[model samples]
Target: MRSWNIAGTLDVVPAAERPDLLAEPVAKALRELGADTEAGVVEIDPEVADTEQFCETYGSPLDASANCVVVAGKRGGEVRYAAAMVLATTRADVNNVIRRRLDVRKASFAPMADAVAQTAMAYGGITPIGLPDDWPVLLDTAVAEAPEVVIGSGTRNGKLLVTGELLASLPAAEVIDGLAKPII
Candidate 1:
């Protein structure tokens, strides 16, 4: 397996070998990706699953971590949902870019209950992988170009380590140049 650029005390192993650490959807998705995939997973404390806490507790660099957020918009009584993947160092441009892409008058983070229910993933561990096929996945250019990134494993107890190229190639993924803005 190729070495990852991730730092800290993470002990990442092939994701396929640790199905127990992943949620069903995540595991199923990885399985569908084939056995030769380079994705890796590391067990983590569920308490620190949030980006900032996870980075601090696990010693992972903020820039090397990615966050997946679900956004929702409504038009003509129909709801549209999309997932955005961005680096921990930045934030998704939900109000502008995502709202425009979704072609809705307004866009905002989906309610936690709805997000968790629809994604069939834990709230603090929603990864872009295994999202509903109908939901567009917006990939921030920066996250898609990173050498390696730590993202949610569909469960708070683990995180997945993968190359940005892999994430960009996911189903329904659309790489956007400025999908995220650096936090100031």
Candidate 2:
């Protein structure tokens, strides 16, 4: 059994993987903030490619995690960008919410390669802490109530479990709503 200790929390991760400080901003920031964290490693497992599958693999309630993402778009053929942290139970309303937030005519998901290269974080594991401060980070209101929510650890092999309050305190996070909607 492998174990990872961050701040003071215990977590289970994949065995035989090296820890990279550059990859996990939440863990690094927590250490800087003096929070105790602990994590563990086990056999390696594949990561979910989509949000629905991610919730299944983690056995986490849809509302228990906040998905941080970077969306890319263009208006008048010029590129635009927006960052958002939304609840697993909701989807960002790019037209009404995120579009206006970024002040762009059109918004859409960034290409996988672009998101990975530009953000410097794994697509499945993007977290808000290490993100460039200038980008707007919209926090779904649901996340504020969760005691511990799973966020991308900036890596593919792990996830960061942290308190909602901690996320609220990030450098430039703004709490908002309508990140997700009931799938029907």
Runs in model 1 deviating more than 4 A are 35-37
Full-model lDDT, candidate 2: 0.63
Per-residue lDDT of model 2, residues 53-113, tens digit only? 7666645565666788787767777777767877776777767778877777777877889
On lDDT, the leading prediction is 1
RMSD of 2: 5.2
Instruction: For each candidate, give its TM-score against the true structure.
Output: 0.96, 0.74
Looking at model 2, report the run of 10 residues with the lowest lDDT sum: 1-10
38-154, model 1: which lDDT tens digit per residue?
798889989988999988987889899999999999999999999999999999999999999999999999999999999999999999888899999999999899989999999
Q: How close is candidate 2 to the true structure, as a TM-score?
A: 0.74
**Cα deviation in Å at residue 52, candidate 2?**
3.9
Which portions of model 2 miss their true places by more than 4 Å?
Answer: 1-28, 32-44, 48-51, 74-78
